[model samples]
Structures are given as C-alpha cells and as structure tokens.
Target: MTLNIVFMGTPDFAVPSLAELLSNGFNVVRVYTQPPRKSGRGQKLAKSPVHQFAELMGVPVETPESFRKPSVIDDLEALNVDVACVVAYGQILPQRALDAPKEGCLNLHGSLLPRWRGAAPIQRAIMSGDEKTGVQIIQMAKGLDTGDILLSETVPIQPTDTAGTLSERMSRTGAGLWPRALAALSRGGLTPTPQEGEPTYAHKIDKAEARLNWTRPAKTLDCHIRGLAPFPGAWCEMDGERLKIHLAEPSQGDGKPGEVLNDALLIACGDGALRLKTVQPAGKPKMSAEDFLRGTPVGKGTILT
Candidate 1:
C-alpha cells in the first residue's frame, strides 16, 4: 500500500524534499507551512517558498500559528496519515502532533547528528570551519534534533562556499534521500540508530554577531563572512556607516587590524587581510567591490572602525 504522507516545512530549504517525494509518486495528501508574513521593502505579506510550491502542486496547506491548540492537533489526527515528513517547519511540535501519524514524524535536518543538533546547522557548520557537513533524516522526538538518524550523506564544505551556496547544494542533494527513506518505511525495514558522540547546538544567528570584529584572524573573519553571507551579512563600520561584506577571501597583507591596506578593498586583520569581493553599502543594493568602490571611494590608510 502507498503511504499517505503529510509534509511540514517552510522556506526554500524544505522545498526539494517535498518535491522529491512528489516526483517519486508518493501520495502527499497535505502540507503544513508557517503563516505568510510581511517582508521586503513594501512589507507585503509573502508566502513561504514551501507554501507557494505546495499550492502550485494542488496540495492542501495549513498555516496554524501554533500547534499548541488542541484543534490543530485534532486536525492532524483527523488526517491520519502514515507519516509526517518535516523539514525546517520552524516550530517545536508537541507530542500530540507526533502521534497523529501512524509512523510518527521524520525530520530532514541539515547537519550530521550529534555534531550540529539545533537550528541553523548549515550556517553553523560553515562558521565553525568544518570541512564536511551533511543532511540526515531522523526519527523525530520531543527533544530538539535528538532523534535517531535513519539516513545521512556527507557533503564537502568548499573553501569559497557561502551559506546560501551550500544550502542550495544541500537542498538538491538531500532531496534524493526521501524516496529511499520512504521505501525503507513501506517495507518496515528502517533501522534508525541513536546519534553518537558529543552533541553541539547550532544556535540561531543573532544580528549582533554580524558586526565584523577586525581584531579576529583573517581566516576566522573569512569564515564568519561566508557563513552569514547573502543575509544578515557580516558588516563593519565604514566612516560611521555600516558596510556589509557579502564575500571575501583571506589574502597576504599586514597592518593594524581594520586598516585599509590598498585600493582593492583589502583590509588588514589580526593575522592577515581579507580582499572584499562583494559588498553592500548602507541603503544601497548589493554590488561587486569594484562597483561599490566606484561610487563610494574608501581611500587607503583609513581605518574601518
């Protein structure tokens, strides 16, 4: 018998897994995503990527503010699906919802278990300078990301990879695991194993952490910049304004930390320097360093506070 599936997710990261399931002819009866929220310059209400995708596929979508309500749990129980596939659903599900499905919930997480076991795993892995990170599907438990892993695959963290770039890759690659996991599920052959080793939390990124501390080593700063790239960017004070760095690479240079080394956007760090490749000036669109400098010339010898 085909498993009747319900998918729960929000944001772009979750789209591929849902897509994979549908592509493999899984009977996805419904989808649950976070409520649409106001965003962008106009503050227009924007549907989450998962919500938009589900709607296009003609899957029913629910956007309950919280599953704390008995009705929400009741509604899920009424669906009575075989399994709930969750990926970045953005809420801690109560135990009642977990019991709604016959086989319980399975979460597709962005990091290897026992390594990064909380929110923001992909960003945290890059920020921690890990050479490898992977996606894992785990049997959901009450605790956060503390479930037994069912399937996992490691992916390399390239030197020049930003959080955005890595996420795109992980999403597509991780999608393939859904079919395998479900096949294992239908045959009652899933062998979930408890996570081993010490656990680490990937705490959500705070905007305060985005402030660049030039006193840190160039390598550290490089990682920091890439980890938070393309959103909540790592920034520095430039002539009393914030200059967000979207991309940079460690380079050879030596001077007082935060000193402008040359015209190529090379800024000295505690150990070395970073050549800023992409940046966004305050109140301006993101642009190449060359384009940014063309409009706002930051002369050498000036310190970036």
Candidate 2:
C-alpha cells in the first residue's frame, strides 16, 4: 500500500528527495517549504527550489514562518499525513507538527548525526578535515538533530573535494537511500538507534570567517579554502584586492607568515607554505596560479596583507 507522506524541504539540496518520493509513487499529500524571500543582485522575491518544484508538480505547498501556531497545526492535521519527510527544510518542526504525522517525521540530514548536527554540516565536515561524512536518515525529535538514526550511508571526503562538490554527491546519496529507509519503516524493520556521546554544532558560515589567516598551518588553510569554495570563498588580501582562494595545496617553505616565498604564489603560513592553485581576484573570473602570476607579479619577501 502506498503511504501518505508530507514533504517538508526548502533549498536545491532538498529538491531531489521530493522528486524521489514523487517518482516512487508515494502519496505526497502536501509540501511545506519556507516562504519566498528577496534575494540576488536584483533583490527580487524568489521562491525556493522545493517551492518551485512543488508548484510544477501540482502539489499544494505551505510556507508557514513557524509551525507553532495552533492554526498551522490544524492545517497539518487536516492533511492527515501518515509520515513527514524533511530534508534541508530551514524551519524547525515543533512538537505538534512532529506528532501530526501518524508514523513520525524523518529528517534527511547531510551529515553523520552527533557529529555535524546543525546548519552548515557539509561545509563544516570539509573545513574540519574529516575523512568521511554522509547522509543520515533520522527519526525526528524536539532536540536539535538529536534524533535516533534510521539509516546511514558513508561518503568519502577527498582532499580535492569542495563543499559544493560534496553537497551534490550527498544530495544524490540521500535520494537513493530514502526509499529503502521508508520501506524499512513500512515493514517495521527500521530500528532507531540512539546517538552516542556529545554532539558538535556546525554554526552557519559567516563572511568574516572567509578571510584567510596566514598565521594558520598550511593544512588548516587548505581545508579552509576547500570548505568554503564556490561560495563566500576563503580569501586573502593581495595587491590591495581581496583574492579568493579557490584551490590550494600544502607545501614546505621558509618565511614569515603571509610572506610570498616564491614566484609561484607560495605564501608562507605558520608551519609551512600554501601553494595556491586557483584564485579569483575581486571583479575577476577564477584563474590558475600561473595565469594570475603572469598578470600580477610578486617575488620572495613580498608581504601579503
């Protein structure tokens, strides 16, 4: 028997999950997404990916600021959903919404829970130099991602992997894993396992954190650049311009921190040197280190502010 499911999600990361359920022939009674907000260069109101997708699929969508209102809870109850599947939905589901689903609410989080349990998990895992992180289908609860695990799939974190690349892989992984987890739940075979130990929260990334600190080790700097790549990218001051570090590698060199050690854009860090591979100067497209060097020259002992 097809299950009555309610989909709750917002960003592009969550679109695949909603599509997966729809394609699998689940009875998706309704969708809950964050309301449209003003954005972009024009600052015009824009609907979220999930919102746009749901509209195209002819599914009724709700965009309540919060699920705390009694009327909102009443609206959810009106749907009489058997289960709710949430993925990257910005808003938190209150206790009432969680209870509204007969079976329960399941969250498709982008990291191994109890590890990176808050916003920005994908970026945090890469920034911390984790070897592996993946999607976790957890039984939702009141606490912040402090939910029991329903299923999980581990994905490797390559040295070259950026947050944007990793997120795309994880998004597809979550879509593939959802059906099996839902089936297990339907069959009463899914066991909820309690999370172990204290959890770490991944606070949202800020523009301030993107400023590169040459006082850090080369490895840490490499991770920082990789973690924030393609969005609010890790940056450093060069020639009075903010240079975004799109790619870099750790190396060995001898010089004061933030000092240019070579013609190849090797910048000295606290412990070693960072070989910048790709960079983007403000108001310019990304270019390779060699290409950038040809345009803007800097030699040994040159200070980088």
Model 2 Cα lDDT, one tens digit per residue, 187-241: 8899999999879999999889999889999999899999999898988887688
lDDT tens digits, residue span 179-297, model 1 = 99999999999998999999999999998999999999999999999999877899999889989999998999999999999988999999999999999888888999999888889
Q: Quote each prediction's TM-score.
A: 0.99, 0.95
lDDT of 1: 0.94
Model 1 TM-score (2 dp): 0.99
Choose the strongest candidate by lDDT. Answer: 1
Global lDDT of each candidate: 0.94, 0.91
- Top TM-score: which candidate number? 1
Residue-pair clash count for candidate 2: 0
